[model samples]
Target: MNIKGAIMRVFPEIPEFDEVDFSQYSTPYAAVLIAFFESGKSGLREFEEFVEKNGGTKADVGRFLISIFQYLLIRYRRYGDEKVEVPAFKVFLTLKGWLNENGFENDYTRLLHSFVGYLVDIAEKIAEKSDCELGLAYMKTAYLLTIEAEETFKEEYFSELKKTAQGMVAEIYRKCGINGGLPEKREKGC
Candidate 1:
């Protein structure tokens, strides 16, 4: 099936899929990720509009998160060279605050756990393909560090989180066989 068909199958109830102009994005997954990030940037008002347009509930948002992660997993598995962009810690804090204020904290927590588990499975697959145990370990460590950073952001521990997240990104870059350590500034589309 096509990308749009796959996305519709994954998220049949999201009306935003119908309204979103996917031509600007190279892939449907990219479109969804951009929408998600845009919603977070807009204090979730856009997300609320998406849900309302689709006649969905907060529970659907949780499902949407899972779908996004699942898409990431698929893309990574199919094209091992694809770099997964880890959002900034501030994005997590904003999303967490929005979930708390909007009464979806529990759902978000559950979905996060599921997402991490999926990452674990993906890491294992990647390891198997590359025949490198250390690579898998690094991938898993990066994922755990990311989760830790997100979890601790509410306590104003962003300095430490930023450091850890940078380390995680470096590890991911290494695992992907990208040479030349973290740049002074990450290039766009990296």
Candidate 2:
């Protein structure tokens, strides 16, 4: 099965929304949504296992995810890349708190720590490269990739996935009201 199939199987009840309204749900729910969009199937599996092992329901998992998302967004807004290292440490502290509260085993906690780190890294990259807002870029990348992967698999059109991904990113930028023009790279000393 494709990534979309994997995601739907893992999160069958995810609500439909054109834009993510973080306020509509608890942090946990929002976190799961972010993870769902950002990390895809593997991220889903990691979250599901963490919850199951710790006797956590989906909401508990969502809360943990949201905490990470909130930390990253706050850091991004405040620092604007000036203090990258500090934000990473702060986010780690947040994840550690959740792991302690949930009584996750040492091994499991380490795995989640890494996963959270990965999610943050990807989000930061998206924010830096795209014209879309950080949150919207996160959502759109995941959404578009899943669709592209599914169609590619069905059509056996494997060669153009890279181009398709690029197109999706550009489309997302346009939708978000960014010019979506490729910035001309300056060549070495004119």
Candidate 3:
């Protein structure tokens, strides 16, 4: 819903899309989310076509792409692997291509940090609407992304995002009956 709200802010002409019913995990909404994931695995053509069809400019599509990527990653962790094959390498390449085409290739640390923020929000949304397991999956995804971004970007913002993601993951694990949660200190061995 946050992603859809962000998209509508850019392309208001697009009508309201269907709300995803979390109870129905295999609903059309899930399929659409998987479609976005699959599209990203291949390339950004689907996103580009969406922008053109919706009368949006390249400059505006960056946030939209970022939003969908966050959602796609969430869905992938939730149900994508069971539904279809999604190679992680291809997704990484597509993300790189998105950054390059959207003019963030040279300096994308901020954008990646921004994505971590969205991931947190998405985890909260899933927590509210779906099972704690699904929410935990999103939190785990967010935490992993933060780790990767922190390694690649080395930005100060990533430290904060990583902490936020770690905190969320800890809370979710606590709720899931995993006491003590993840270690607060990042392991030197990891």
Candidate 4:
């Protein structure tokens, strides 16, 4: 089977994460992620309009976060013990906290668990369907995060094109936390 076929094989039967499957991302899954990540004020019609206006893909304002941060995650194991202040796990933890503060109903553990679980599930699906020896899969995981930033941090998303992904993520975490949602755990790890 091809890579896209592999992606379809692992598609989640559950609505939330299942809709995020890379292949379905062109339609149903894509729309769901857009609605979930975009503003509560946005309607399905509006989302479609945005997509139409943006030339097929949703006009994700924070599109680069996924690409650059993904690099960080893949490289984490190699750098975990090198005394780097922000390992990928830590970055993920921080992102989890941010997700929680943004009302994801999660702490770092739950957030990372959900996120990683989603990724692993997709990877398994892809492996099952595809014959490719190796693939950079998560790059396909773009629509969700950008839609998230577009809704949650419109200014930050549009203000800079070349800022560090680490800084952008940290800033998003802070703002989303301070936006009168759940207070982040004051612990250093949080």
Candidate 5:
């Protein structure tokens, strides 16, 4: 999506702002993001306090925070190259939340779908590294997101993505040696 470019276009004042220094703000960003996910409004105050504590000037903190969030999502899909502060699931949650809040839910449905696909792609990459369980978890989360989108937006495209996510989940399950369907029992085998 070239989010960095979009940020540059939106905030020309921060013209010299290079790549987001995620490492410098990862802790606070994760904290405020988690707060936002939980309590919604509190995150704003927390974010302000964080900026103040971090010695940020009188710039647009709100927009800066949103940029950080959007960058987080952008980086999350980059897989192993970028160090994402928030978890993968939380990144998807925040992206969806941001879209809904900014009235882009309907307009950017395809972007959301692409993010879900990226999640699945990342999961497959993780599975290739012999982490099938984690891959399955991510695929399941993608499936859940697609289902929510289908129910909320009533779009046939989300339904198709849901089916694709389900197939991905099943593929990971097979890789994990579970055959098909849910596991009947948990066995502690060496």
Candidate 6:
């Protein structure tokens, strides 16, 4: 195969946004996404496995996959040429790229197996570079936050979460392709 042909054929399957209704999701989705992203190296596998293991069974998985993509795309924008510079996510991106090169193998639901794999690869590289222990210590903390964030989304007050999360909320909003800047007119509140 020529280089262009090989590139096109390498991963025959590209995820289709077919019926993803992102607008239907509430604010907590963004909150949960921020938590997943904040977890960095410690939570990559947890999120990836959650998406992969539940592939095709749950409706939320598709949303979850796209949420992750948006998160990384924001990372791509935030860090630009340095998205892989983090000591945790380079491992994730590399491994994900490897998996894609191998084949676009997906269980049919989350369509995010590849994306998750890539995140893990980047995380792995970061861990190696930083020499941080990717162990239960951080895992427990990361998941605790994730679970809490998930719950906050299910509550009636879920819409308020984005305003309450401070930096995490802001990052999540940015990742979701929303350019949340200062309000047009300054409010009394800071």
After superposing candidate 5, which stretches have Cα over 4 Å from the reference? 1-66, 72-89, 94-114, 179-190
Better-scoring candidate (TM-score), 1 or 5: 5
Candidate 1 vs 3: which has more TM-score:
3
Put down candidate 2 lDDT per residue, 1-190, tens digits, no spaces. 1333333334333322112232322343444444444554444446667456556674566455445445445544554543333333334444445555566546334444334334334444555554467545553443343343444344333225434445555766666777645333234365
Comparing 5 and 6 on TM-score, the stronger one: 5
Considering TM-score, where higher is better, how would the candidates rank from best to worst? 5, 3, 1, 2, 6, 4
Quantify all predictions' global Cα lDDT against the true fold.
0.46, 0.44, 0.52, 0.33, 0.52, 0.34
Q: For candidate 3, list the clashing residue pairs, or say none.
A: none
In model 1, how many backbone clashes occur? Answer: 0
User: Model 5: per-residue lDDT, tens digit, 37-71?
Assistant: 34333343454565566565324453454455555
Task: Give the runs in model 1 whose Cα sits over 4 Å from its true position.
Answer: 1-44, 81-83, 86-98, 114-190
User: Could you estimate the TM-score for every candidate?
Assistant: 0.35, 0.27, 0.43, 0.22, 0.48, 0.23
lDDT of 6 by residue, 1-190 (tens): 1221221121123222221222322333344444444544223335444435534223343344344345444444455533323422322333334344435324221323223333333433333343223322222222233333334345433333323333333433344455644222223355
RMSD per model, one decimal: 11.9, 16.8, 11.7, 17.9, 11.5, 18.9
Judge candidate 5 against the unseen true structure and give its global Cα lDDT, from 0 to 1.
0.52
Candidate 1 matches the true fold with a TM-score of: 0.35
Off by over 4 Å in 4: 1-68, 77-85, 104-111, 114-190
Q: lDDT value for candidate 1?
A: 0.46
Q: Count the backbone clashes (under 3 Å) in each candidate.
A: 0, 2, 0, 1, 0, 17
**lDDT at 14, model 2:** 37
The number of clashing residue pairs in model 6 is 17
**Prediction 5 TM-score vs. true:** 0.48
